[model samples]
Target: MADPALSPSPQKHLAANDVVSCNKKSIDDAENSRENVAGETALVIDSAAERALCRKFDFRLLPVLAIMVVFAPPFALLGKKIGPSRMLPILMFSFGSFTLLTATTHNFSGIFALRFFLGAAESAFFPLVIFYLTTFYRRNELARRLAIFYAASNIANAFSGLLAFGVFQIKSDLVDYPWRWLFIIEGTLTVLFAIFVFFYLPKSAAEARFLNEEEKSLAYHRIQVDSSSVVNEAFNLRESLQIFKRPSTYGFLLIEIALGVPLQSVALFLPQIVQRIVKNTIQVNLYTVAPNITGAVTLLILAFSSDLLRIRFPFICLGFALTFTGFIIYAAIDDVERQIKLAYYATFMMTWGTSAPSVLLSTWYNNNVAHEGQRLALTSVGVPLANLMGLVASNVFRDQDKPKYAPALITTASFGGFGILVSACLGLYMVFDNKRRDRRQGVKLSARDVPTSRLRDGPKVDDFRWFL
Candidate 1:
């Protein structure tokens, strides 16, 4: 009703302001939508990358497993014939040479071939080392010694992570890729170390150059009495095969099956697990270092305690329990980003869980087996059988199970739980069997009560008791 120009001017101003505001809102909404799409695309790309990496790792594992199974027993026999000290050096040198060759390979098939040969070279290294330690250390002393030996691997794992981080940082004019430098460095060091060990290590405790005649005699006598029924016995394939006839051998193998999955899972996928909490690649590698070092420390503690207490299965079970809990906790967490500290802690527990069981389980079987040939036989099968479970690990951590990997976690935990049960049952059976043997003989003779020299027939003798 006022002057047309004045009224219309106010309305027009208000209309223009609304239009401008609407346009600005639309622009902001478009920007936000575009940003969201970009973020989603990044996540998809990350997931696909993770899947590809997992597949590549799985492919690498296949050839190693195949070679290990096919070559382990023959290598065990070879170890026994030549002796661990001498045989180990040859293995070290061969594997190192292969590793060096691996650095030159540009294709997948080349690396695959090298890995197969590398596995062949390393087929008997672990069992031989276990057998080797039994020659020098008594049954009770073996755990801590093996723990120390096993700790080296854990330390190497931690060191490798730190090394990777540092190597990745290196900017060089001569070398284009950091990974090539890693292979060259590791391979050279390994070859050099193998050469040193070949000269340094004694063929047997009896042949040890560092020992006095009396000390050598004492060392040999200690093993003959407590550790081995037949000290430095000749390898007899027929007699060695006798160990497989026992029911306990199968039980031990079952435990190995359970132990291998979790062990390999941590070995293979720990960095990926760490990746959930840490988005940065270098940071993930660094974070893994602490957990591995902690694992080594934990292994030392558990091994020392087990040795002090002179028990094996309890600690092995404890390790399994830790593994089970860690996986369960990690899988149960709905949002790892929010509960990052807890998720990270689970990784520590995973390391703790895996490290001790391997040392203790190896010690367990070695403690019970007194025949040198039989020990090697059992170990050849047992260690490789456990390692073969890497196949299970490699498969279960599928591309579809990316991020949480809930199914893989549950499966691994189930194996751990199964290990706990089997180890406990076997342990209990040992306890009961020992008691029954004690009652039958009318003398409560513990395993230590009898010298292993007379118990060479193993459980066949009436006086023989399980080393519970």
Candidate 2:
């Protein structure tokens, strides 16, 4: 055995070691460190098996998501009355139960029925959440918050794909198909989360459990100062009807329809589109992950920029431009197999526009609607009407268009271009309309005199300029 002091310990070696040995040891240590780090990260880069699980489902099930229109309007109205806190929990529980039940479905009818109820349960969630958010946030604060909320959905979509990639790799003793496990695990999580939501989410800023009395009061007062509108005021019928008569409302409805077509189409059919380019199901899901993440990032960037610049329509136009150009490229590239890289790039472009218009369009009306009655009507009518484009989306990409959905891509691109035109026209109208209001008042009216406490009794349309 070596003497204790002379043994090759690092301390003893350092004292006796030559400069060349010390340098060599340092190089060895760095290489060893790199090897250890690479070993630790090997699992992260190795996802080949997980991606193999992204096979297509029967197209008939597409109606499950699209059917939300049937239940959305009435539910929006109910959520307005009963409050989203009460309604959201029940809806979450209902949909989560249905999603749980979907795993056991062996027949088409069972799947369809479950999907239908899922749609019913989720119909009002988005619009109601938007309406609920408006109660607390000021107009300037809304777009960013809404973008963040919307970004969460895109993040979920990205996460779900990544989750599916991993979850499908599990070798189950009880279940024959790993696909069934997807529904089982995700559905259970949703149910558990709904329970958490029920306990955690506050009904409104005033009722928020996390905030102190002072903070809650500040929250309430800020919204008051921002819009001079009452929070959660009772709805009115005659005044709500006035929104329907406005030309701007129709313009909004038309623009939403145009935007919704591509949005829904991509949301529902992305896996299928990617499958055409990549034969493997796992690769399809893997490929989709990048575009989705890009979309979410683009959405957040646009939203914060819109808030920073105090502009909405210019971003809306930019979103449409990206969407249209993507679709146009997709349409022009007839040889998908030969031009697969370009086709995939087009998907990134298509997804960039999906969240912007929907978020901004809703906020536009929410900001301008002024009173509770008009706000509720827009939430109830405009949102559901915009969702009606889902029906068009569900039917557009026919079986004959398999592999290359040229017609569907072109149609969606056309819609995007038309939406841009409508947006421009609406912007011009808002500018002219605001000018007319200023001339009528002989000066632009200030929001100071608007009542802060009463619902449906705040500033009139002429008193506030619309956000273009």
Candidate 3:
């Protein structure tokens, strides 16, 4: 069969120097605009009352607003049609441009409009990356690779906090306010990074420039054997709709919602949580680094273990267990000054548990779902639907519920507990289903059987068995 319109070309090659030159040009083009935005934000922030700005706009805009504009399933479907390598860089550049524009906002309307665009741009990214990665690696290898990929976010978070700590100290050199520099510097770097992603990332292993032809064939054939089909299935709505008929799709979505609440609450409100213990702004940012670094390490270890055991549910449940324990402990502690050290340790648990489930849950769904279009549709809805729970987190942790923030902590822990139950139920269902299929084949659990019409459906095909 001929390649699809968005399929990658094996012959489209460029030299390393060309890529470097292109990135340099992109940086140069973005610099002046970044300067202008930073200057405008600085002026507006300096003139406006800071607390009033925080209350009127930042507080109201922070939650429940932009996320409603996000509809990622279509873009996930579009990535299916157009190719992720082509699609992701464009999306990255678009969001980065919006980030740069955000620095120039003179009032609530300007910032609000730009933020909506930013969320719309970002909504498709996680699902696209998950779908893209599944095409390259086998089911067993995916969790670890995704864990490694996700750790980069934790690492970036650590660095960004440290960078903001230092950058915030600059005191109006590049802009009238240091916060304006945050957007300018980060946005410019993101644009530059998008240039590299465009040039370096291959659309598929078969199109990878660094691989020998033999290596490419081996990579492609490995997946072909596993799925009994090539990665690029024909785009079809009938197949997509068929996915909704599966019980696991709804199960995975429930698990995603359960996981997303703590993940986002911690991501957005960790500093605020830490501030309850520490007095200084610099110290609060610095304190966040240790927990994030710990989370990254825990994520990698759990992922490696998941891949090593060739299992999924145990680790996901373990992660939720940890998060639940942490949130419960942190919330239970009323005396911050007396148990500050203990409360600090609880943050480590929250970070560790929250990090693993997000990566693993996605891998779990991808492992179970058979068809390309079905996986795309499920994840497109699943990933953003998970993030949409961020609205719940935002509402739970309002200004009225500060310092202890008992309401938010308790609510997040409850979700974690719910996740644990849901994951265990799903795992049990798969195990029982697999056993029933094995028994009906007149085969013992450990034995190989003669191929029959049922068996001939192939791995991940009509006769697909779930991975425990």
Candidate 4:
């Protein structure tokens, strides 16, 4: 204490410690700054990768819109002859091969030929699937099952946007264009899946390997009793053609015509529609994702509810109403850019409207038709006929109609309104006819009370009640 220099020298010691502390603090700050920069960079990379993946998936699906109106009867007949389990894989493999070959196309003519074959290959898929499901599930159970199947399409629509986004971002030396990669990836996946389905799927419930002898017998019996007029019936073209003689067939086809227009309108031009709200192409693709997802979710909910309630027409009508409202809302708005949120919400309504009706309508007609061959015949025509309306949608949404596309929206809305009217009339007719049968028989027997095995002749039979 007396000799400060010789002693501890507290002030000097404190100063030295302060300098050390300052150095440590500076080092810590520098390390933290570096860590923050690294973290930010990683996050940016992850976000970019995710966007790219989404874009890739989206772009691949656009080719699906270019379907050709090939006659479906031959394929339907083939399905009947070979069974859908085998026929489906063959079709899938053919389409996948064509899709793969499309990647090599250097000119429009080459791509056009591939697209024609692709469309031909896919033409019978939905009709065959509808026919196949009816072979297994009961009428009441069919809607939800179809909903589950159809949900994949809606999800694809959503992912198609993301896929397109992701795929377009692909900068590679291996492939000159991003589209080639899209075709390659989609084709490979389709071929692989086709192979897997070929091995795994049973021709009929009776042939299912997962089932024991008892379960197989039970499944077959269930379909025979409630689903089909004749389980595993032989294909008869003359007999199948007799389905057209029924006035109801004409009515059903008319409804399909109405459904097709709005459906194709939304599906083909959703990107264009979203573009009005979002100026950026990438953002347009991204925005479409939510609406399509919402459509899928809505489709599932309505289908499940329809199943639970054991009704189809009401749900179908509700879907039409939504479509009508969506189109009207969008069309009514003068400045979509000004009210962006509302315009965006209208697109969601449009998706909700179109998704449910397609599934329910298919289920509705299938539920009513007990004969397997006739059911396939009608579906083959009806589904493609609906798809063919895309031509009408394509023409109506002209280049000049830019942003709002008022004329196109109005036309689509008109079709939605027409669907509601047609479905309601048909539903009412079925109800009155059922009542007339009940009065004549002097007994009240609901459609569910009588097994479909008894109603093979459809409306011609006294025991028949329309599965409305």
Candidate 5:
């Protein structure tokens, strides 16, 4: 047995008895520690996996993931060239083109490489956009505005299901394989849309065509007023690392991972699950869109409430709560009839909570961090890090996890529960973090509020607020 007297350091994750163990023992300890993290509440995957998962957001899984890993660094630094505002459209358009072209592939490898290319192109926008938008919007305004952008994705999700179902409905001969047509047509349209976004969208708050000079000034000034960071600040690796001083980042990341499998559970497996219940592939495809549509509406409603109340906790909590109940139904129900009903309801959790977190994390980080470099570097990792959990969730639904996929459902439900707890904890911590900072250094109350909360004084000492 291991020594109980010598406890591991509070900050260090160490084996109780094997501090000086041999190579095998070290490996065992390391494995055990990882298992503990998995069992507890760590984001199970790493950066590359997260980016791959995110990059694959447009395309399918395996091929897109490989491509995204290749493409990530360029997107990470894209702001230096065209800026985040301009880069978003440019990247999206690039991705759309590649995705559309995926129709002509002759083999799996061809599809794989092309999807990879698309992955590279699509990798730049989502995380950075959240960062950019949060700069112009206040914490109160963050979720709703973020939802505006995020809501675009819901359109894609809902439409993709319909498109897939419809395409699959085609007499396989004319389309030459409906699944292939699905890739080709969607990819092509996205490509064209990319061009439109690239040309029309603004470069930043300063340059947005839709905003009047007054609005631009107000937009730029408002964020600077509240956060004490400029729109065009450089990326900071060191300061981003300091975000670890706050545990919420990790907490959010864990939520992202836990939610990953469940969301994917639905995305990757939902149609298949429907097929098990319904005989017609057409019916399966048609039914897929319903949840996303409902989810999109739920998100819009929740987003408005989040902003209206000038609060993050309640809506986020509401999302997880809904998701948890959905998962509970999914897990607990055994009757084929009830299971199918519960499975359809599970979309509420995934479509709503799954998509909102990136927005929340983006808002939370952007609202808090004042250094441009730090914000860039942090968000650069933040979203990809969260999506990385997809790897963990992806593998859970094996062939063995059949019918109800009881194991997967139960596992995802546990994760949703964890997400609820973490969001609660993070919300409380944000309040506490502010109080401690204020008590110790008098930040963000009297004089600090002038620069940090109001943005009227221009950028000052890199102080900012969290979106909570």
Candidate 6:
């Protein structure tokens, strides 16, 4: 055909000599460009259609409220049975089948069944997303990536009410009840996204398209200096179980519970709270959106701050303090107008503060606990257990609370105070332990030595510390 240099496809010149020469030049170029702090891949994926779908598929209350109340467990069980990779296509077909059923279901039990499957499918999602995100970004990069992911809550909070308003307009010719349409539209989007995930997501960093052999090696070495970066890995179930022995692992799990439960109060009940003020079901739904937008902005600020501080406990404690303040406004007030507005503001503050700690804390435990199994065990328990508290959270705003759930707000506030104390104590413990270990003869705590999923990505040796 053509001479190698003049080939139509630039990559056609893959001779053995060229491979090494290209790799070396690529490495040199990479070093010269340096680490790009601002990641723009998320932008690369965005088109008008993708942006609209991202907006439509926003999955607002799925985690904060929807999953436990209705949508998460069935697909999770299915993921166990069908395998995570296989679960999506299965879920897509199943979701479509159920959406049709949900559109016609005439009884509560049928409604409950549909909701259960929805929950199960959703269960596999959040954790997988977090784990998947790690395989793409380096360790130091994770804090920002996680911040963006966690921003979903803020986004949900910021916009849920507004979306409900628009969906309600479809009540006339939308082909289903407003509530039914909620399930149908969201479910369809889920199926579509599952398809995207299957095709595009890299199996691991080594498998990523953009990096070459040397860049991959550099990525591995930078992360491995502290995080125990695996090379062409194997799964280890035994190691996953060993994470339970670490006190820090359990501590972070407890911290997550403190963060996750209050989230539901805002995510699930806010619309219901609007019901108390506005009589129209649709309008009430619409009202729920405004506060969440405010909440999202607040969360962004907290996450950015947490990343900048490079500390977990202090931010966690601060989140608790903000949550407690909000709860106090709700708990201490009697006037309905004041209570509702303050309640919204309180939730906004709580959400902003609460979002930062999970990544920081989970990453902390993951880093401190060296074994892969332990990190997996801690994270697996930490997230679901953090969520399981929703069973209790759902009932906290009982019928007696009416427009002002003073008692529930108070209990939540008390939990917030408990979290603040726990984080403060943990912070002190971390400092003392770091000092004590410095004088001893064991594995010196370094960034690369930390076995967290985050550390296995990328972090400069000295700059990335197991600060938490």
Task: Summarize candidate 6's per-residue lDDT along 80-164 as a digit string, tens digits.
Answer: 3334345444555465556656766879999899867755554555554444334333344445555556666557555655675
**CA lDDT for candidate 3:** 0.75
Off by over 4 Å in 1: 1-70, 169-176
Model 5 agreement with the true structure over 1-468: per-residue lDDT tens digits: 667667556534545334555556756755664454334322232445433422322232112211221154358556644576566656766776777667777788988998787877766556666666555554556676666566656656666666666677777566566777777666676666556555654555556666556555555554554544455665555544565565555666675665555555665676666655676866776776777777767777877776676676656666666766776776676675656666566555556665555455466555556555555666666666555666766677667877667777677777778878877887887677656654543333322233443332222332333456
lDDT of the structure predicted as candidate 2: 0.71
Better of 1 and 3 by TM-score: 1
- C-alpha lDDT (0 to 100) for residue 336 of candidate 6: 55
Model 4, 1-468: lDDT tens per residue? 387667767888899999999978876865564455344323323435333432432232212211211146788778988998788778888899899999999999999999998998888988888788787676777787677677777877777867866887899999888889989988887888778767766788677676667556666666776678899999889988889999999888988999999899889999898878889987888898898999989999999999888888999999999999999999999887689889999999999999999989989988888888889999999999999999999999988998889999999999999999999999999999999997775556566766677667999998788888
- Model 2 per-residue lDDT at 412: 85
- In the predicted model 1, the residue pairs found to clash are none
Please, what are the lDDT tens digits per residue for candidate 2 over residues 194-218?
7766665567766666666755665
Ranking by TM-score: 4, 1, 3, 2, 5, 6
Order of quality (lDDT) = 4, 1, 3, 2, 5, 6
TM-scores for all predictions = 0.83, 0.78, 0.80, 0.84, 0.73, 0.72
Please list the C-alpha lDDT of all candidates, in the order they appear.
Answer: 0.81, 0.71, 0.75, 0.82, 0.59, 0.55
Write model 3 residue lDDT over 249-342, tens digit each, in one string: 7889999999989999888899999988998987998899999999999999999898777789999999999999999999999898999999
Which is superior by TM-score, 2 or 4?
Answer: 4
Tell me the deviation in Å of residue 62 in model 6. Answer: 18
Please give, for residues 14-68, the per-residue lDDT of candidate 1 as tens digits.
Answer: 9999999997887686566445434432322343533343243234322221222
Superior candidate under TM-score, 1 versus 6 = 1
TM-score of 2: 0.78
Enumerate clash totals for all models, in the order shown.
0, 2, 0, 17, 17, 26
Give me the displacement of residue 344 in model 1, in angstroms.
1.4
lDDT of 5 at 377: 60
| Model 3, C-alpha of 403: deviation from truth (Å) | 1.2
